[model samples]
Target: MAVQASPQTLAPFLIEPRFVPRVWGFDDLRPWFDWSRFEKGREAGDPLGEVWLTGDDCHIATGPYSGKILADVIAQEPRAILGPVAPRVESPLLIKVIFAREKLSVQVHPDDKLAQKYGDPRGKTECWYALDSQPDAQVAAGLKPGVTMDQVRAGIQNGTLEDSLNVLPVERGDMIFVDAGTVHAIWPGSILLETQQNCALTYRMYDYGRPRELHIEKSLEATRLTTRAGKVLPVSRPDRTILVDVEYFRVERLPVRSQRSSASLAASDEPGPGLSYLFAAAGSARLTGEGFEPIEIPARGLVCVPAVGSAFVLEDLGGLDLVRMSPRWPAAI
Candidate 1:
């Protein structure tokens, strides 16, 4: 994980995929990536909920960084691997491909203030980018207008809590932001790319007759009763477009065509020191820089690119569509 390289010498590298099972999950994942390669311990009928693209424990899959975990890379070469924007040596963002076959639990996350009070480092604020969806697929975001905590408690007791939620229909390419304190749930048949804070602290309020533990009091304390509206409508752009920009992270959608040369992908001027994550949603590409060999990234693959004074480019792109994620300081915004 530790590489004795300067920031300018760093190259983009791929991470191993981690498949996670859940009760409300899909048996097959399609149109995003093939799930056949990941059926070792899981049976054909077992539900697979998530594919974690990058994490502290995820192994580097390519280049000299191969066989190293992300956490070790950060610890050994914090600045050269993470650049100037990283808040700490550790990665600040977590990315996942979520497939929901059934409704997720009605849950809420505490804000940073509440999280610190509970002895955690930070709270969770996440955004979902819809990759594919079945008909009638929707998400319960926030609470209904004029709804009160008393009413929410009553509905939960009577099993009518969903009626008090603001359900929003979803389709391909739609972006939905879920801030901390917003009560939310992902409905069935939705495949989404979720980007969020590294923390996994969720306070569940209800779970639709499942025998899961309920954090009723904690959820009530975290929930913001006002109408939960966090959808981000992206504007039309030719090359790159900002999807969501929050204090935790900024996400951008970038398109590349085979017609464009590698030089076209690079900035007109050299980029300053920074680190960014790239996810290839469609097609394939090769990441190239001055110091390393071109790293081929398959469709639906993820890459972490760290730049010092120079920038990296997506060469040999065959109509690739990418999602770029970068961390941001809350104080700057």
Candidate 2:
């Protein structure tokens, strides 16, 4: 039997959003996503903490590729879709919008070495871009300057692990890069855009008396006792800013100003030659390429741009704020 190939297009395709419920979730997800669009018939108190924008299971919402899973599309057209930097057949980066109403568990993730040893595919190194924050909102990242492994263990045993953490206040537009093996937690009243390696192997160290299981031995083995902190730095460029450049992925903030035409917007910057996830953070825009029909990307929506040589443009309606995330083969320090 002659097998047929799935259709391919260089144009961007929208991805359906997946809401994940959590115990520490918040009911409201605004500016980032309008929960009312998808949760119309649901109950009022279904607190959703994370909105998975891009995953293997995320399906295409429109165009000829509608209803097709992202993983399948990648598998069917690996070279055409993934371009020259196709790390694997599957997408290497995971994008999500996290809303924390209450404190998350103090956890640590293994590095690549430990992940491989523990029979996991990959480790998690995540970066957070704060979209919104309430007054006094804070996040605990890394251990205190002088905290040692012995102290960490003692604090965990004595229910004082938080005391050994360095908590810092956060606000909108702040960026934080969390390296693998760093002990961290996201405090209450925060909405963040998180980009991480495609892995979910979390080793919980402490959960603040929650009933969930704790991985003391495993977390301790993965935890780095040395002092580490994520600095809140401003991005250099307004048109396109490289927010995070690490081994796993590279996240850039691209603000498409209100342009007259697609040609003018495309002239703003050169699109990289690889698979990139385009997330509409604020306003709506029209995604147009050479031959494919234009696609509308509403606020809080996500679109996948295939690896094509021809650049695409986002015709900004008002002001379109987008975050572009792509996988990097070798770690870019």
Candidate 3:
């Protein structure tokens, strides 16, 4: 199969913000959803609202595209994005724009080896895109300078774990890349877009002194304890584009520019041989492929194209910015 953009379709999605609980109440959407609530809470000023633009919240779609479950889809198409069939299902990536109403638990993810060693079904490697931030919004990226693994483990047990983690304040548009084994957390009052491998393995180090359950022994085994080192700072080219790399995904940001936009189709910009999913993050753009409709993906709307066919043209229809994501190598993934 070739890489091509076919008309995209939408799967069902839940208003995933944590505070208010309603599986997916349309009435509660205004307050429950964070970034792009239509009337109440925070408005996601874009056309597709926040959910549709980044279908990370969308649950299930079609063959090999699994939502809420990774094993099943990978079983159907191992090479689709999770990689060549061999062991268990490996989702190439997972995406989510987190609205942290409260601090997230300090956590670490295992790599493939550790996951298998612990008899875990999957591991995690992910990144973040800051869409909104509060004055005190911060992320625990790495360990504090000069902290050692032995010190980290002891700190967790002693209740001083926060002191051992690197706390970095974040602003809107900031990007952070997290490889496996990195101890990290997204603080409350921030909205972020997260991209990671389709795995659910997370070892919570601490949950804010709150009596939340702790994944202690497993976390101990999963924690890398290596001093936080070599964390990358967010960088945008002279063109204001940012690229962040996680173990499973490579994501790029293109600020909406002209009424007309053009770029060569590159796998590095996407994830696998599968077609890229384009969402009008902040603007209105029309995508015209060789044989498809000149479909318009408004801000908050999404479109998925298969990895085949010729390059298409994207035209920004004023007051619009867009985010386009695909595999770095569609065939190889």
Clashes of 3: 30
| Collision pairs in model 1 | none
How many collisions per candidate? 0, 1, 30
Q: Tell me the spans in candidate 3 whose CA falls farther than 4 Å from its real position.
A: 1-91, 209-211, 227-242, 255-263, 267-275, 290-294, 309-311, 328-333
User: Sort by TM-score, best first: what order?
Assistant: 1, 2, 3
Off by over 4 Å in 1: 1-8, 35-45, 259-272, 307-310
The TM-scores, one per candidate, come to 0.89, 0.88, 0.69
> How much lDDT does candidate 1 score?
0.77
Q: Lowest-lDDT window of 10 residues in candidate 1? A: 261-270
In TM-score terms, candidate 3 sits at 0.69
Per TM-score, the best of the predicted structures is 1
Per-residue lDDT of candidate 3, residues 221-251 (tens digit): 7666553333356566644354565444556
TM-score of 1: 0.89
In Å, residue 36's CA in model 3 sits off its true spot by: 11
Better of 1 and 2 by TM-score: 1
In model 2, the number of clashes is 1
